[model samples]
Target: MTHRIQLAGHRWVRLVTRLAVVLLLATGGLVTNLASTAQPAYAHAYLVETSPVDGEVLASPPPAVRLRFNEAVSFNERSIQLLDTNAEKLAIGTPGHVDGKANTAQVSLPTDLTEGTYVLAWRVTSADSHVVSGALTFSIGHPSATAAPVEQDAHRAVVVVDAVGRALAFLGMALALGGALFVAVLWPAGRSDRRGRRIVWSGFVVLAAGTVVVLLVQGPYAAGTSLAGVFDPDLLGAALSTRLGHALLTRLVIVLALGVAFGLAVRHGSPPATTGTATTATAGAAGAARRIVLPAVATVGAVALPLTWTLTDHAQTGVQTWLAVPATSLHLLAMALWLGGLITLAACVLVPAGRRETSRAITLEPALPRFSGLAQVCFAVIAATGVYLSWRQVGTWAALGATDFGRLLLGKLAVVLAVVGLAAGARRFVRRRGREPLGVDAAPAAAVRRLRRSVVGEILLGVAVVSITAVLVNTAPARTSYAPPVHTTVPVPAAAAESAAGLQDASIEVNIEPARSGSNVADIYLTGPDGSLVAVPEVSGQLESPDRDVPALPVTVTAAEPGHYVANSMSIPFPGEWVLRLDIRVSDFDETPVRVRFTAR
Candidate 1:
């Protein structure tokens, strides 16, 4: 009867191992390419247009300020602040979504506005639940009498804290998930190892603390406030109001449950007592009864934590959330399992051998091949999921090399490949060991040394991968860089013609397009006073808004058609009456400099 039960337990273990392998393979193949079809700009919210368009010099304040985005947004009135040059807040009504438009939000403005420049700074929740904010300045009559334009790095403190919190959370997840797996599967003897237990406990603590920090930082980040606001109850409350907040809160709850599972696993799976140790056989029997149960609970919590992470990040905002979220969550799990297990193996199994503990070290030899097999499965999943995410994130090959996010991703990939190569080396070492028993002897010790070095290399590379991943989460994906610029034609209402250098033979007719505070194409038509086309030696222009103390904007024109010269692109920095000085070279000997007033609104 005892032999039959032992055989059944062994079969159960084998079945569970087979199931895990099958799941990883099936998941990797099933959605390996799904993310490639997802939306290119996974989580970024773009401002399509704004009312009182950027740099508009309005004679009077508009009734309301409207901002349109390409994606649906969650409106927060308090997040939209109107400040004058002195940085004094203006009276603005609550913000609301525009009627019949899901992507437009507007805020009512006070009609009684004085003649001073005002800046509208806004933060909104994008469809993917990420916060996006920007500032636009428009003058009431003249530029506001205030301090010099403050560099926008005003929220650097909060950004740093947010990034730190993200890194901690990611690191914590790796430890907790990986550490738990080590104790549960790869090294059951780890149950008795002090380092292994501490690793698991430390992982839980780190993850929990990181989650708290992230929750605290989210509110202030969304509010675009300084570091002090992290403690603001109101701001924290505002964070809790968003879907992201709920996801974070749920993660905390899940972590709490995860802690309980770890505790239960420890209590129910206490190691065999050493000679003279006070631990009882009864306790061990109890542990044996509930051994599978505690690990199962731990596995669920591990999976749940990654799910919450996916819900609040790019995966959630991705075009195919259904596929991306699960695939990404699985990817994270695979990483955690592979990395965490290796860490545990090194610290508990391999590192101890260096201290001359050959007996304990030999006990770990059986687990090495098992972990290698698992790692192979994990690496496959990582590669498959990574390919899908790369296609989704980087859209084009040019962007992969050109964009910051893509560059970071490339760096991460290079390091991962190195880690994989090391892992392969370790696997080769494991295979060469064959069925021969390992010991404290020279050959086995050397083999162990080689494997440990490779494992250590992998761990170091893993840290780099995680650090880069934290930064990647904060970066705008490469796909966003591919968006085409908005180009619109704005006809210059004035047909005002200016003649060059005492010569009425060639007059310059200048027209600016979509006269706004961005790149605009200038059409300079050279014509005779008789309304006939005329050609000039060369044509160039510059813009200066004297009222706003703006500098000269250089414009280089090229001949696109006969008698018609066009500025490839010129930037109009502010909304006002800009003097478009057209330098028309009528001849090598004589040049005509003509000035025309261009209203950029």
Candidate 2:
């Protein structure tokens, strides 16, 4: 009889596992299709180059300061400032995008300028709506006697508070959602259990507290001000004016509604009741009213809560956002169900937290099998959504080892795998105990104790996963990890263009790749007076430094296309200002020569 029962159980488990696999595959295919139809977008932008390069010394004040980024940027005019060594702000025009260039910002400066070191601090909003800021120093005439560093203490405090607030909010939501799902769907007895009610209430409190802290910190964070500036009305106004701020405000409102709905759903025998129930002692009409009103309100609040997280985080800005947003929401909901349910199971059923003066009316046997099935379903959804999100966020295998975000994701995956393994072990104990008699015995007691220990271990691993996720959201996506340093562009004067030769009235443009000492490629562009490309029969160049008396290095130029010439190999032995002279022969009869000066260091 025992052998037959074991075989039957094994067959049932096989069927359920197969069904989970099928469901995951179907869902994954649908998400992929949705992503293919969504709009194209990028992640974060990186600053690639800047005008008046950092640590540069200029003889005259530049008319305008410029910044060049790898991805297109939207300037934040209020965050741009030029401060002197004494920390005094200088007069400057409003920053604007350069004509025909979305990736560059230019701001004009006052004509009259004194000699001293100055810091140019700027902040801009990226294409994805994330804020980025940086500072660089340039000396006017000569280095200053005393230069104050850029302010940073305010920024550091904001980062700390934001991180803490985000973590707390996520944890609280998971506990609340998971605990409520467990009580409503699996353990109806939990509706009246004090311990279960407390678990759900705690989640509500933590989430509410976290929301307030985040809202308070947003003001100072955006203004880059000190902690005391959190109350500044202008700073608060800046924070509330953005799309992210609107999402946060909506979250607070959702929390209030959730509290009311949850209170009705959980507090039994009250005029309102959760778990779709009413007080037995109450009159029939009141009981019927309680049954209809409370569950509907609770259901709406539960579904709307996770949507707030989806709108504010990486999902809103990531690639294929149409698919990403829903995938992330489902992932969060599944995680809450799995992790939160495990906690409920351990506390209320498996271990029975309170004193067991006598066996309670509720038994663990009925709840265990139902929880097992629910957990399997939740894990399936999590696994499927996790795979989709990983592909969306970290596109390449190289990024898995190279970027901080990728590494954190890898760590989270490992912990979850361990948790799954422990869960499988507990499931085996359940099956083994099932084959034996139903009453309590030495063997049955041992199995139940071992299963509880495994469940506890899974809960600990779940906490680690949540903590890593909080940090990962703040990190930049790996796609924009590498960027080349900024280089100077020198447009040689047309007066020096050897006129009367075939190359008459032609202009020359030489761009040095990386513009640094060592092997580099020099791309020479030739244009006519009409701004059209001028084809040349022959072109050659040489790199030399008059100050250092460096030996002239010959650079051979090959025609890539009409008016485009490239030198495959141009070697620079040392750092210094190097002059590149391009000799162009438009025809056999005319030879045109032009020269431009640029720094290599």
Give the candidate number with the greatest TM-score. 1
RMSD to truth, every model: 9.9, 14.5
Clash pairs, model 1 backbone? 117-144, 490-514
The weakest ten consecutive residues by lDDT in model 1 span: 488-497
Q: For candidate 1, what's the RMSD?
A: 9.9
Model 1: CA > 4 A from native: 1-42, 75-77, 85-87, 99-102, 141-151, 268-295, 352-362, 435-443, 483-601
Q: In terms of TM-score, how similar is model 1 to the real structure?
A: 0.72
Stretches of model 2 off by over 4 angstroms after superposition:
1-41, 48-78, 85-108, 115-117, 124-131, 136-155, 270-300, 352-362, 434-443, 482-601
> In candidate 2, what are the lDDT values of residues 463-505, reduced to their tens digit?
8888887777667765444123223434434443554333356
Cα deviation of 496, candidate 1, in Å: 16
Give the distance in Å from residue 470's predicted Cα in candidate 1 to where it truly belongs: 0.8
CA lDDT, every model vs. true structure: 0.70, 0.68
Shift in Å, residue 7, candidate 1 = 31
The stretch of ten residues in a row with the least summed lDDT in candidate 2 is: 272-281
